[model samples]
Target: MPNALIIGASRGLGHEFVRQLAGQGWKVFATARNDAALEELRGVGAHACKLDVARPESLAGLGWQLDGESFDLAIYVAGVFGPREGAKSAPTRQDFDLVMHTNVLGAMQALLLVAPMVEAAKGKLVFISSDMASIADASSSYGWIYRSSKAALNMAVRSAASDYPGATFAVLSPGWVRTDMGGENAPLEASESVAGMLDVIAGLKPEESGAYRNYAGKTMPW
Candidate 1:
């Protein structure tokens, strides 16, 4: 069985990934920020750990704890939707900081810490990015903070791919799935989005590194 590590498996897309991957016989190590959530993840048969991706100390501890383990897949799935008010409205400093620190810095930090393990296994490193991050496809003037964070995330992952040639690194847009972040009005369900992503992951190639792709494995603009 392939060993997989999923960061931020407390809920939503992260939790769904744990559920599906475990069902498919992958040996999954999942992380959440709290014990209750970790327990919930454990319920789905994933080995759960506590992690606050934005914190350097937490990442350091995690790196130490998993010292010799190698993972076939490692995904950074933690993010925040900050200040729903669009580009027109100015967000408080706290909300803006929260979004950037959690999405961009947090993901980058996690990837840097785990890259060695992923590379050792010649595995895939996936960052859960967003279509909103697409500078080449921007049509809306909303969620600038969230948009900017994910945009930075995409760039960071793309840059990391060049540095970590042994690992297949890519960003994925999970579509408007009906999760807590996507809201009730969103069209697609979490299952559908995760299933598509699993299919894409199953067929990942080293040559596909640095690409921004959708859940269906189609390339998206960076």
Candidate 2:
């Protein structure tokens, strides 16, 4: 069975990825901050671990724990939608810091630790970015902090792509799915979004490294 690691599998899209991958017979390493949720993922045949993406020490410990093991697929799904209300001025410093730490720094730190593992397996690395990160596609001003964080994440992955040529790297936008972050009124369901992303992931080629694509496999402007 192929091996996969999903960060932030406590709920929503991350949890769905764990469930589906385990169902498909993959050896999954799922992480979540909540012990109960980690246990739930464990019940689904995943090797669940506790993770707090915002902490460097936590990531360092995880790297030690997984030493010598490699994964065929590594997906970073940890993020926070900070301060939902868009402001005309700017998000408070606290909100900006929290969002950037969880969304951008966490992904970068995870990549630093996982890059060698990915190179060892010659697999793929995927960062779950957002469509709102696109400067070209921007028309609204909402979620500016969330938007900027993802944009930084995209840039981070693109820069790391060349560093790990053995592995395919891509940033994916899951679309406005009906997750807790996306809200109940969002048109796409969690399962539907995850399923489409899985299809897109299955078809990813090494040549397509650094590409920004949506759940439907359509390329998005950087």
Candidate 3:
């Protein structure tokens, strides 16, 4: 069975990834912040670990827990959508810190540890990004902070891809899915979004490493 690791498997898209991957007979190792979520993951046959991506100290034990394990896929899905304010309104320091730390710094830290395992197995490393991060397609300033963070994340992943030649790195946009962050008015469902993304992932070629694409497999502008 192929081994996969999902960071931030507590709820929303992250949790859905765990369910779908496990249901497909993948040996999934998932990380969540609380016991309840961890138990839920375990109930679905996933190996669950306690993790809060915002807290660096919490991620310290991950290396030891998965030592000697090689993952066929590793995904960093932990992120926070901060204030919905536009450019006219600046985000507070607390909001900036919370958003950037969870969405950007946390992924960077996790990549330092998880990328090696994916590389060891010559697997794929995916980061769940947003189309709002596209600089060329920017039509709105809404959620500017979130957009900026994701853009930074894209750069981080793109830059790091060269260092991990054994692994394929992809920055994917899940589109406007109806999740806790996307709200009920969103156009797509989590299941549909995840399924589309999985198909895209399955078809990714080694030469396409560091490419940015949507869940539907369309190449997206950076």
Candidate 4:
């Protein structure tokens, strides 16, 4: 069976990625900060791991543990909703650093660590991006920290694409799904968003790398 690794598998859309991928028969390396919340993922057929994407030291161990390991698909899904203190501002230095550390830095580290494996396996690397990254759709600057981080992530995906000529790289926006991060009032369900995302990712190719798209597979203006 193919192997899949999903970061942030504790809850929300990340949890759904673990469920859906495992259901599809992939050997999923599912990670989350909380062990209790992660049990269901292992029960549903995944290898449970605790990964804190925010801490550089925490992530370093994985590099040593999985050195040279190849995964059919690597999905980087760990992220926070910027800092709660400044949801509207440019984000305080602390929150900005936290958001950038977890979302952008963590993603870049993961992609870089796994690049050789992905290149060797001719595999896929997907970054869970957001429609908020769309410069054309920026009606509100509510999530300034989160939005800017995702935009950076989109660019990182492009950089990764350029680094690997044969591997598939994708930047996908999973839509406003109902979850802890998306809140109880969001427009989409976890299943709906994840399934749609899986459909788009299922058909990803090298030519499609660095493209900004929604779960429906429509290109979002960047």
Q: What is the C-alpha RMSD of each candidate to the true structure, in Å?
A: 0.9, 0.9, 0.6, 1.8
Candidate 2 C-alpha lDDT tens digits along 94-152: 99999999999999999989878987898989999998999899888788899889999
> For residues 76-175, could you state the per-residue lDDT of candidate 3 as single tens digits?
9999999999999979999999999999999999999999899999999999999999999999999999999999999999999999999999999999
Candidate 3 residues lying further than 4 Å off, grouped into runs, are: none
Q: Taking the tens digit of each residue's C-alpha lDDT, what string does model 4 give over 53-90?
A: 87777677777656666888888888887654334445
Q: Comparing candidate 1 with candidate 4, which one achieves the higher TM-score?
A: 1
- TM-score attained by model 2: 0.98
- What's the residue-level lDDT of 72 in candidate 1? 96
The lDDT for every candidate, in the order shown, is: 0.91, 0.91, 0.95, 0.82
Considering TM-score, where higher is better, how would the candidates rank from best to worst? 3, 2, 1, 4
| Best-matching candidate per lDDT | 3
Task: Compare candidates 1 and 3 on TM-score and give the better one.
Answer: 3
TM-score of 1: 0.97
Which scores greater on lDDT, model 2 or model 4?
Answer: 2
Q: Model 3 residue 192 lDDT? A: 96
Per-residue lDDT for 54 in model 3? 88
Of the candidates numbered 2 and 3, which has the greater lDDT value? Answer: 3
In order of lDDT, best first, we have 3, 2, 1, 4
